[model samples]
Target: SPHIVLSTLTSYCPRSPHIMSAISKAKKSADDARDAAAQVREVLDKIRSALSHHAHDTSLLVRLEGELVAPANDVIRMKTYTETAAKFAGHLKELSEKVGERIQLHEDTPASQRTLNVAFVARTKRNASQIKAVLCQAEDTLDYLHQQALSSYAEVVLEKGARVIEERKEERKEEQNRQGKNQS
Candidate 1:
């Protein structure tokens, strides 16, 4: 009886492309997000170092602004990946829930029938557990990406604000120099 149940479960457990595809896509997205985050970090570091040494250099600020564009684009890409991952996680959660319901139904059957379905229910439970694990991983990845994007955006805004203030100060200094010359 056990052998028959094992054979039946094995035969029915054909690998589902949907699960594999979701996993592959999630992995790729996560890799991309990591790369993007790294890029953002690198750019921010460079900006920080340059600012420390050349805070009054307008040309350096311009160059840093140009450098920031790539990281900003990376952040946008990360945001997109995060959204896609969220959708994928939602779908996986639904599938997991359905599997759980199926397991419960099998368990609720009459004792004689439940005995026969024991292996099947066990396999379903295992699958459901795996789905939950993947779902949790997806959520974690989404949160990470979201935080990176927000952080990058904030840094960029602050850098731009600093640049604007520096430019204004330079303009004011020039205006004062011109006034002194005229008065002389």
Candidate 2:
């Protein structure tokens, strides 16, 4: 798991729409990326067919390389991101299990058979301590997963930016060459 078996956030989570939306977005992005990869594969197959017809064509080969490499890299990054998300979900499930345990132990206990005054204080303290332990574990798990996801995204963005910069540099150089040839 990306994080540990983990801790509980609250006794009752009550299904936040924001959390659901985030999960949906993550799944959608991975699916979209997968679809993009499929399209890229089709493009490569066409490139291959074109190259087969013209064995000595540098343009087709260049197009194949340029088209395949970036998307291939992106697919790898998306795989990592999705795997990390799955780990995060596993830890969250663990947390939910812990919360359920807490509910069984405390909230469901018969109130008529309950402790009073100092005893109540002691019980609360014990419950608090147990909950705190669970929460601390959960906090660490979430923090670590957050760090990993952010790092993955940052790397993807940086790699993409690097590729774009290189492509733009090549374009500017070509434009300059074209202008020089016209001037001459």
Candidate 3:
């Protein structure tokens, strides 16, 4: 009797094209978001590595100063990756919202007449939540890395400035010594 009822409901209730299109878009967005997240993770790892190396050796900061100026450096790459991931995340969020609206529409249907399986709806909700969580994490990581890069750049400038001041002081002392000797 339950099987008969399910068959009758399935035959009578055709799936909406909008719901099908939303599902297709959600799947594609999820795949693209995953790829973007992976790229951002790689950028984060490179930033961590550079920061760790600089921590172990102050001279590495000088090297970082040069790398920062380069076009293809980790900081620049991280920015690009993070931007791309953020775009994908936003798109995915929109798609998930559409899917949620479709699910709500199905849930509103009378129990005996509902075409969507309860378990299927629950699983879809869980998947959307998980994808959002992952993308949020990637964005957070990118923000942290960007901050680190800024801090590193500031330190390098300060170090260079202090060195210049010391050199000028040394030059003044040498000039004074020469003038005194000549007067004597």
**Number of backbone-clashing residue pairs for each candidate, in the order shown:** 0, 1, 0
Candidate 3 residue 65 C-alpha distance from true site, Å: 33
Candidates ranked, most accurate by TM-score first: 2, 1, 3
Candidate with the greatest TM-score versus the true structure: 2
**What range of 10 consecutive residues in model 2 has the weakest lDDT sum?**
2-11
Off by over 4 Å in 1: 1-116
TM-score of each: 0.39, 0.44, 0.37
lDDT of 1: 0.51
Candidate 3 local lDDT, residue 181 = 100
Number of the predicted model whose lDDT against the real structure is largest: 1
lDDT of 1 at 87: 56
lDDT of 3 by residue, 17-106 (tens): 443333344334433434444555554344335444432222342343233233223323344246643444554445345445434644
Candidate 3 local lDDT, residue 163: 50
TM-score-best of 1 and 2: 2
Query: Mind sharing the TM-score for model 1?
Result: 0.39
For candidate 1, lDDT tens digit of each residue in 1-184? 2224323333433343443333344445555666665665565456445444643233453465457557546555454555644554454445346445544655556556544676755754554455445434544554577555444444433444455456567878999999999999
Runs of candidate 3 with Cα error greater than 4 angstroms are: 1-115, 179-184
Candidate 2 lDDT, 1-184, residue by residue in tens: 2011001111112233443344344445545554544654564455445434643333454455456555444444455556643543454445345435534544444555445445544554454444345434534443454455545434444444455456567878999999999999
Score residue 146 of candidate 2 by CA lDDT.
47
